[model samples]
Target: MKLQKLTGVWIPLVSIFFGLLAGAIIMLLFGYNPVAGYIALWNGAFEEPYYTGETIRLITPYILSGLAVAFAFRTGLLNIGVEGQVLVGWLASVWIGLAFNLPMIIHLPLAIIAAIIAGGLWGFIPGYLKAKFHVHEVIITIMMNYVALYSVNAIIRNVLTDGSERTEHVAETASLKVEWLTQLMPNSNVHAGIILAVGAALFYWYFIEKTKYGFELKAVGYNSYASEYAGMSVKRNIMVSMAISGGFAGLAGAMEGIGNFGYMTLNNGFTNIGFDGIAIALLGGNTAVGVVMAAGLFGVLKNGALNMPLSAGVPHELVDIITALIIFFVAASYMIILFREKLTNIFNNVKTKLQKGRGK
Candidate 1:
């Protein structure tokens, strides 16, 4: 049990270490002061209450996006349409936020539910087509990303506003920005979304690790045909998995619309949160606890990178390079496993020789 726990952490830790080392080497080659750069990063992420709060805010959506991807993976699907799901979810949430005049207690939950349902329905399209028509989800999901991008822009221009570039700000009743949290982390855009994020993580842990449905999902993931043979509803499970994955992704969109931005605007491009979730989920080994930690790591790296040029005369883009290296290392973890085994064997051989010498 101990070894299994250690193994779960080892791959990501080694990947992060080598990635940072390689980043330092690159900085050296480019005549940049790596130590100063690192110091600046550390300060940016944790130097004051504001930066700390910002990092936490950044982590909020990442956790949801990672959970979205990880949950789908657990159920034999790759939900690449999370970007679309987030777009629809954001629009839906903000629409509810603007269109409603209810009390805070009612308005907030209604907006959240709207977002979840919108995103869930968006995901259902691809899952249904895949399950019923035997179409590949990846192709449909990728195409839907462009559809989402254009559709959001059109909706903003034609429907949401009076042909304006952005929607009106959400009502305070529907907003996630609470007075207490703002006072707690003054001058930061952090909001109550962190609470939602943490709660969602707990939900993910319980659902994916503690429930019978989770086992059936994993079983379907391993082999759909076999799961069906064992009397599981493969098609129903697939659709349910995608919908749930998208529901999580939709909540991530709410973190942006109602929490951070408080409105929806014309999106000229993808939010990239869904794509980043893929990397986050991969690094996290598809585990709930691992996803939370990985989200924190990414949050720090991204938030801290903003300070690099100002503090150390280093380009912030180096963070992207380091992130890519870390992911590459993760992808090559088999080599790390082999290296560890070789070292273990060598250590055993040396211990055996020393024991023989002592006996002789």
Candidate 2:
């Protein structure tokens, strides 16, 4: 157990080390000082209270988004439609927020529920198709992303436009902004969404690790045919898993619509949060705790990248390169394992030789 824990910790650390090493090599080849660039990156992300709060704020949605992908992965599904779900959720949340006026106690939950339902419905389509007809989910999801993009744009232009390319701001009751938090973290957009995200993570961990339904989902993931043969309802599990995943993604959108931006605007392209979630999920090993930590790391890199070019004369794109390298190292983890095993064997052989000489 100790060995397993150690390996788990070291693997991610090693991947990060190699990723940074590769980035440094690239920077050297391009006539940049990696040391200065990294220092600037660190300072940009952590130098001020405002930057810290911003990083935390960014981490909020990333946590939920990463959970969405991680949940789907644990259920043996790849939910590429998270982007679409987020879009639909954002629209639904903003629409409801603008359409109603109630006390914060009621309005906030209502808007959140709207977002969740919208995202679930969007996820349901692909889930239903995949379960009922064995259709490929990846293709359906990719196509649905475009559908969501155009659909939301049309709605904004034709229905919600009021001389702008966005919907009206939501009422204070529906907003997730905490005035005290904003005041406390000056120049930061801190909101109550971080609390929600933490709650979601706890819920995810509990449900997946402690619930019977979660066991069923994992069973199906491990072997759907075997699970079905054992009388588990594979189709139902698939739909449920997808809906839950979509709900998480929807909550992520809610953070943006009601917490960060307080409105829905025309999206010319994918927001990239869902794509980033993919990397976050992979880095976290599709686990809840892992996801949260990975999200924080990503949030730092993203927020820090903004100041790298200005502060260190380094291209911000280097962060992207580092991120890609990290993912590549993770994907090619077998190489790391092989290298470790070779080192272990060599050490053992040398130890044996030394002991034999001593005996002689």
Candidate 3:
């Protein structure tokens, strides 16, 4: 068991090392100083209080989205619709913010709940279809993403605003911003959403590791037919798991609406927040602790990438390439394990032959 856990940790760490090495080679090829570029990347994410705050702010939504994807993965479902769920959640949370005029205690939670519900409902549609008719969730959820993209844009233009590209800022009562926190790192977007992210992470750990429902979900994931044969309600678990996953994603939108941006805007394309969650979840090994760590790494890479060009004369796209390479390594981790085992056997065989010859 100890070795198994170590293997999991080593796999991702090795993947990261190889990815950085590849990035360095690429930078060398392009006549850029790799060390300088990495230093700039590190500085961009942590050297200044403002950058640190922004990186934390960026990581907030990533944790939730990572949890969203990881939760679905645990339950043997593919929730590609998290992007759509985010749009609806953002729309709902922002709408509540725009429409409400209540006390902070009531207004804030209300908007959050609205977002959770909206995103949950969006996810429920595909979950229900899969549960009832055995549909492919990937296809349905992919289509839902486009529908969410267009519909949210339309709603923002037609209903939320009078044909405007963005809605007015949300009320301060509903906002996640706190003056003292902002004062801690002046001009930073960081807010109380980090608190929520931490709490959600704890909740995720407890639920997935401690609860009976989580066990059922895991069992279903291993073999849905077997779970059904053993008298588990496979259909019910599927729906509930997907809904829960969607709720996490919807909360991610709440971070955007009330925490970072404090408003909604029309997008010409997908923000890729949900898509990125897939990679985060993958890198995280679908664990709560893993998700948080993965999200932090992503935050650093993304926030730092923007500074590469200005600080080290390296294009930000290099970071993108590095990220892709890292993901590739992760996906190919099975082959890595196999290769390592093969090398180990070869070494053992050589050592045995050497010992026999010495004895003779």
Ranking by lDDT: 3, 1, 2
Q: List the residue pairs that clash in candidate 1.
A: none
Ten contiguous residues with the weakest lDDT in model 1: 330-339
The best candidate in terms of lDDT: 3
> Which 10 consecutive positions of candidate 3 have the poorest summed lDDT?
4-13
CA-lDDT, candidates in order: 0.90, 0.90, 0.92
Each candidate: RMSD to true structure? 5.1, 5.1, 4.4
Report the lDDT of model 3 for residue 265. 98
199-240: candidate 3 lDDT, tens digit per residue: 988999999889998899999988999999999999999889
lDDT of 2 by residue, 108-182 (tens): 999999999999889988999989999888899889989999999998888877547988899999999987888
Q: Name the 10 consecutive residues with the lowest summed lDDT in model 2.
A: 4-13
**lDDT, candidate 1, 33-139, per-residue tens:** 99999999988998988998899999999999999998988787998988888998899999999998999999999999999898888888888988899889889
| True-vs-predicted CA distance for residue 209, candidate 2, Å | 0.8
Residue 6 C-alpha lDDT in model 2? 69
